[model samples]
Target chain A: SAVISQKPSRDICQRGTSLTIQCQVDSQVTMMFWYRQQPGQSLTLIATANQGSEATYESGFVIDKFPISRPNLTFSTLTVSNMSPEDSSIYLCSVEDRGEKLPHEQYFGPGTRLTVT
Target chain B: DQQVKQNSPSLSVQEGRISILNCDYTNSMFDYFLWYKKYPAEGPTFLISISSIKDKNEDGRFTVFLNKSAKHLSLHIVPSQPGDSAVYFCSVSGSARQLTFGSGTQLTVLP
Candidate 1:
């Protein structure tokens, strides 16, 4: 298990503006992932951030809208650009803890609640 | 198409009773299934998980049962407590290692 924290726990922004959420882990991790949970909806994976590579985004997400930066093994940032009311959601970051076995578990950060008005 | 499905949007159970949450997946290639609990304004917390090779896995009061043939899985919480009230999500992952989540079930444990 890993202890994770996100900055600006909750924020309200105007539409067409942008906000960047930061995630920091207590320990170094190889794989970090970003997720979004819309109101009354399931969590959707936004992108995967590795220490030294370009982030891999899910099908519906684009880099221009949600750019990610992984400067090191312990830190990553996700910026929601040109926000819209539809983009209001809780964004979370998770790290995969790989064990010697087949099943690996992920530990998550508390999440950043963003509301666009 | 939605790969994962959790039909029940909400469930209410009395304290000290049982709470059951069901989930189904359309893809047979998925090898891992997991359950997560979420409180308001918080991230989803890992509850339990089971591999495709195993029929069941237990962790404390939470147990996850997987049926690969039917592409179904369920989570059972015994002796539910009021603190257990939260939104539960069912997530599945395949070889790609990215999780696909079901639309969550909000469980309310009435005291």
Candidate 2:
């Protein structure tokens, strides 16, 4: 398991503003992902960030709104652009610990709790 | 639509008793299933996992039973301890190996 660190563990931002969350892994990994857990909801995949490529967004998610960047294998960033109150939720970053056959059973970060006002 | 579902929002069991948490998935293509434990303000931790080929898998005091035909699975914890009180999430892995998690069931171990 990798120790994943997320910056700004939490934050409160004004509506229409953006918040960029940072995720750093202790060691190099093959893949990293971003997930969102809205209030009283299940975790939803936002995108898969791979080094040297544009993040692949899931259905109902857009790169323009949730831009992701993985400059290297051990670090990635998710920026919630033009945020709204509805975007308030826990944003988590995870890495696939290839050691498991379930390739993407991710080891998650502490997560960034975002509250939009 | 929720691909994975842990319909039971919460369950309570007495300590030292067996606690059973159930989960169901709509996707039959998921070949691997896993259980993750989550504590408040913390990320989920992997607990146990089972492959579709097997009906059950056990680790220490925790056991996972899968019913492939019914798209259902369960986690059985025998002699449950207070430390077992937490939200349990069921996840299924697709070919991509990306895990799809259930809503989660909060387990409370009563003394």
Candidate 3:
């Protein structure tokens, strides 16, 4: 299990502005992921952040919209650019334990709730 | 398209009773399934998981049942508690290599 913390627990932003959410893990992780969740809806995978190289984004999502940065093994940031009312949702970060023997070992951060006005 | 689906939008269960939440996946390539619980203004916490090879897995008060043939899985909580009142989400991962989530089911454990 990992303890992950995200900054800006909740924020209200202007429609054209952007918000960058930071995620820090207690331990170094191999794979970090970003997610977007609407109210009372399931989470949607936005991208995967590795230490180096570009992040792998999912379909219907683009880097220009949600750029990710993973400078080290224990930290990552996700920026939601050009926010709109539709982008008002919870942004969460998840870490996948690489060294674990099990195939499905992952943990989530507290999440950043962004409400665009 | 939505690969994972939790049909129920919300469920109410009596405290100390059994609460069963079901999920279904459309992709046959999915080899791993997981359950997560979430509270307001928080991330979804991983609860339990089951491999495609197993039919059932249990830990303490939580039990996960998977049926590969029907492409269905379920989480059962025995003697549900008030603290368990939260939104539960079901997730699946397959050749896509990324986890796909389903619409969560809000479980209200009423005393």
Candidate 4:
């Protein structure tokens, strides 16, 4: 399992402000993903961040709103732009670890809890 | 529409007993399934997973059973512990490589 960490464990921001969440992994990985967990809802994939490439976003999410940056294999960031009360949720970062003998597994970071007022 | 569903929102079980959590999916393209456990203020942790080729997979005290025909899967924890009190989520992966998660089921193991 990989050790992943996110900055700003919890934060509260006013509407119209942006918050950038940083994700760092202990080891290098090929794929990193961002997810959002709304209150009373399951996790939703926001985008897939690959090193040296533009992030691939899932449906219902656009890059303009949730921009992702992956400068290298072990680090990435997700910025929630123009925050709104509806955008309040827990943002998570995950990395896929493909081992040589074991099956591939995804590990997650303790998410950043963002509340917008 | 919700492709994955966990009908039960919460469940309470006694320690030393078995705890079963069920999940159903509507998409037939999903061939990989995973279970994740999460506590308050923490991210979901990987627990167990199963492929479409197998009906059941076991890791220690945790077992995951999958039924392709019913598009249903269940996670069973034997001799439940109080520390296992957390929310469990079922995730499915198709050809897209990304996972789709079901609404979690909160499992409370009471002493």
Best by DockQ: 1
For each candidate, the alpha-carbon lDDT, in order, equals 0.94, 0.91, 0.91, 0.94
Give the true-structure RMSD of model 4. Answer: 1.1
Q: Can you tell me which runs of candidate 4 are displaced by over 4 Å?
A: A101-103
User: What is candidate 2's CA lDDT for residue A71?
Assistant: 85
Between prediction 3 and prediction 4, the one with superior TM-score is 4
iRMSD (Å), candidate 1: 0.9
Interface RMSD of 4: 1.2
* CAPRI quality band, candidate 1: high
Instruction: Residues A1-117, candidate 2: write the lDDT tens digits.
Output: 799999989999999999999999999997898999887777888999889888888999998999888888889999999988999999999988877464346799988999999
Q: Score the docking of each candidate (DockQ).
A: 0.84, 0.64, 0.78, 0.81
Error of 4 at A45 (Å): 0.2
Give the per-residue lDDT of model 3 (tens digit) for B1-111: 788999999999999999999999998888889899998877788899898989999999999999999999999999899999999999997765578899999999999
Chain A vs native chain A, TM-score per candidate: 0.98, 0.95, 0.96, 0.96
* Worst lDDT 10-window in candidate 2 chain A: A97-106
The list of candidate 2 runs beyond 4 A from truth reads A100-104
Model 2 pairs in collision? none
**Evaluated with lDDT, which candidate comes out highest?**
4
lDDT, candidate 4, residue A12?
Answer: 99
- Summarize candidate 4's per-residue lDDT along A38-106 as a digit string, tens digits: 999999999999999999999899999999999999999999999999999999999987786333678
**Superposed Cα deviation of residue A11, candidate 2 (Å):** 0.4
Q: How would you encode candidate 4's per-residue C-alpha lDDT over B1-111 as one tens digit per residue?
A: 999999999999999999999999998888789999999988899999999889999999999999999999999999899999999999998877688899999999999
Per residue, candidate 1 scores C-alpha lDDT tens digits across B1-111 of 889999999999999999999999999998899898999867888888899889999999999999888999999999899999999999998998888999999999999
Docking outcome class, model 3: medium
The residue-level lDDT of candidate 4 at A4 comes to 97
